[model samples]
Target: MMEKHVQEFAFMKCLPALTLAAAMATVGTMIPVASQADTSPHSGPAQATASTQYPVPTFEGEWAIMAMDPVKVAGNRALGPAARLLVTLPDSLQKIVGQNHFSLSRQSGSAWQGKQDDLTVTFKLVSENSAELHISGKENHKLDLPLYRNN
Candidate 1:
């Protein structure tokens, strides 16, 4: 029949467009599901419990400068020999690094955080005997140190 033939021809002409519309609809539905999966706790920018997950090292000892010697100077001359950090644990959390003293607040993972006056000091442990310390002063200064444990 001619009518049947015309209907078949119209369907053939619209076949590609129908297939594309179906594909677009499927993708649109999947987009929301995919976004939800990204926001889930199992993946993507989740809160780090790195402190609990990793073993935190102690911050009770002396740390000596391994690099950036001249930059740590407080006055006209370098505080040679005396140019080291002495951290007394627990109670006072007293720190004697250069002419500044910081009170320890938290020691988590490979990091140590403290306060000196209004400034914050952070120490990122490099190894069991080495760490990188950043002291917030007039200008934030960093020191890469190799610690020599005294007991």
Candidate 2:
């Protein structure tokens, strides 16, 4: 019938729009988001354990990592579970690392080490104004870098 043909034509006209709507819905779902809740014990952000308590409080201040050097500076300052380090990495090194926070601990004297996931950063105090930071990854060997401190 003519009425049936008209209905079919209307559906055909709306076919592209319906297809586009379906595609848009799928696109929204395609973007993956990182879950805040993690099931693994060590997979989430740093937790305040008795052992992870920072022993250097004297070095507590707004510390910024500038340059690429291994510097050692730690005193007795407790880094709580919510502590996070703002890191600015080189272009080549940014791909492997995610938005993970590094937890630092004093080794001995002026030596310190920070860890985030499988990455380890060693700090050696070069001077009161300057320091050194070396980054090492699980898959990669030793990668040393220098760091300068501001206040």
TM, every model: 0.36, 0.39
- Which pairs clash in the backbone of model 1? none
Q: What is the lDDT of residue 128 in candidate 1?
A: 52
lDDT of 2 by residue, 63-89 (tens): 344542222333333344433333445
Residue-level lDDT of model 1, residues 1-151, one tens digit each, is 9999999999999999999999999999887753444655666333323353223333444555434221121111223332223343222122334444443434555555666664567655554544566655546554434443333
Best model per lDDT:
2
The lDDT values for all models are 0.48, 0.55
Candidate 2 achieves a global lDDT of 0.55
TM-score of 1: 0.36
